[model samples]
Target: MLTVNKTDLVRHHVPVTMADRFAFRLVGGLSTVASVLFSKRYGNRAVVLETVAAVPAMVSATLLHLRCLRRMVDDHGWIRTLMVEAENQRAHLMSFVAIARPSGWQRFLIVLAQGAFYNSYFLLHLLSPRTAYRVAGYMSEQAIQGYTRYLEDLESGVQTDIEAPAFAIDYWHLSPQAKISEMLVSMRADEAIHRDIQHAFADALVAGKLLPDLPATDLDAGSSIGLDEKRLDAS
Candidate 1:
């Protein structure tokens, strides 16, 4: 029988996907609705443009959200529960882009533009440790919440055949807060790196860089730098 090692225990990595972009999406969606209303109220191109801007914001946020999740699935295999979720998003975007409607492309373009803005923000934050630190603080809060929820769920009468709890107890005892903090901090650092790479890809697109015909995992290899975190040092 194999024995469990406390040292090898790791906290679950929750994806900052749609939840992270909810506010942006909600605001953008509302703005889009408002734009439509204003356009109807007064036949002004300005209102149409304002409404059109929301499309990009919504698209970019949604696409970036999916991109983030796809990376998560790559890092950790598809969790069945999220399977439908991931599929639904892809489906919606595909239909939205392909739908034959006036100004559909314009709206989608707006979404694409938002993606660029968000990606730019992600890159800027990635380059600046100070900004990343701020983001880390936010991430830490979320991590702690996830950790607590996991613990509470496990504390119930039910038990798994696996010795995960025993391992967790022993491991957490050695350096509880330190481990959690480290995991959370690492999350923030990775977020910065992801943003940076995404920005590069977005720029390439802006500069007329053709989308490469790459394998499913090709992007995985290039976009994922966190795989080497243990070997890399922070200056």
Candidate 2:
């Protein structure tokens, strides 16, 4: 099993603050929207390049988000958290490979194609790290709510400490509250995972394995597929 340094997680998060998680979701949504708009104006090529560059960021964010989620849920039982985290991780890794499966010849022709694109936007937003972090915080809150709902659905009798969000993706015809709640929760979970990916890049930077820069594209924006056991088995 692959593991990272737990020391990076400073405090024991019996229950994390909802503020940061919700903030993260907002930023993530904004970032995705911004990326899409940029792509529309610039062309899909630029978006593709940016997506490649943002891979590390995507991975870091996803990993850290999941890590925190696992810690929170797993405090009660590893079996459950492991099940969810593994599923989520597999989805993330698969998505990474799918988006990055360009031809080797094309890759060779375009050096740092992905990195250049991802970093360009990241740099623009660099001055506002706190704001960026708040985006991540929002996402975190939503994910907790969303995942709790999933658990609630699975084990109907189980009582989660947090209230399950009233909305879900499949049920998109609901009211404003339900719809917004669903989006927030789902986006929050995604942001947490995305944050872990950014952290991974940070680790690489610390190790001198990579240089600092913004990801060119928004890697997490495209895919909506969730991780499942079948996907894990195939991988």
Candidate 3:
């Protein structure tokens, strides 16, 4: 597995391809509704979103690693990139757990949701890696929208911007006295990068082009970052 430094950032990365389009839009619709409903209940939503955040990346990484092992090709660092993305997302979950400790019911729900998403995404990737990447890309866009609303809520006092959780400060290497909002900003950056990374891969697959080997933090084109505790890092 590969690990790398995280950063703070979001950009606009949008492309429309047939397979990627269907997958992105299908998942995007559900995420849109989730964002609308969960934008208000910050803690609960964070738990839900983060719970399933890393599933796709982890699944993809595993599959990619296996493919490389079989083919005896390093995949030009893309596997490592995927692994780093998975780890970053898991870290996001840890940060959110500190912020919003879930109840028993929520925990059960998380288990169910995670299992379902993982299996479904696994199959999707197996059948069509390109479309699977598209799903991730679009789901991320929805998450970005959700977190953008969350930031608004914090700033407007609709949701209190509590002191950032301790783990978050350490994980992101934020200032000793960083605020929750700042943590969100840092997380948002990671999500944005992942968003682009996934979409870029999908685009390459569609175009029959070589995949980029750049770090997760460095991707081409514009992509809007989603902030959490980001989630997929929330997620």
- Looking at candidate 3, the ten consecutive residues that score lowest on lDDT are 219-228
Q: Is candidate 1 or candidate 3 better by TM-score?
A: 3
Q: How accurate is candidate 2 locally (lDDT)?
A: 0.36
Q: Write model 1 residue lDDT over 10-50, tens digit each, in one string.
A: 32223344432442344345446545643432113222322
Residue 196 in candidate 3 has what lDDT?
76
Q: What is the lDDT of residue 13 in candidate 1?
A: 25
TM-score of each: 0.25, 0.26, 0.82
Q: Summing lDDT over every window of 10 consecutive residues in candidate 1, give the lowest-scoring window.
A: 1-10
Clashes of each: 3, 49, 19
Winning candidate number (TM-score): 3
Model 2 lDDT-worst window of ten: 226-235
Q: How high is the CA lDDT of each candidate model?
A: 0.33, 0.36, 0.71
Q: Between candidates 2 and 3, name the one with more favorable lDDT.
A: 3
Please give the RMSD to the true structure for each candidate, in Å: 17.9, 16.2, 6.0
lDDT score of residue 204 within candidate 2: 39
Model 1, which residues run further than 4 Å from truth? 1-177, 211-223, 226-235
Q: Rank order by lDDT, top first?
A: 3, 2, 1
Total clashes in model 3, counting residue pairs 3 or more apart in sequence or in different chains: 19
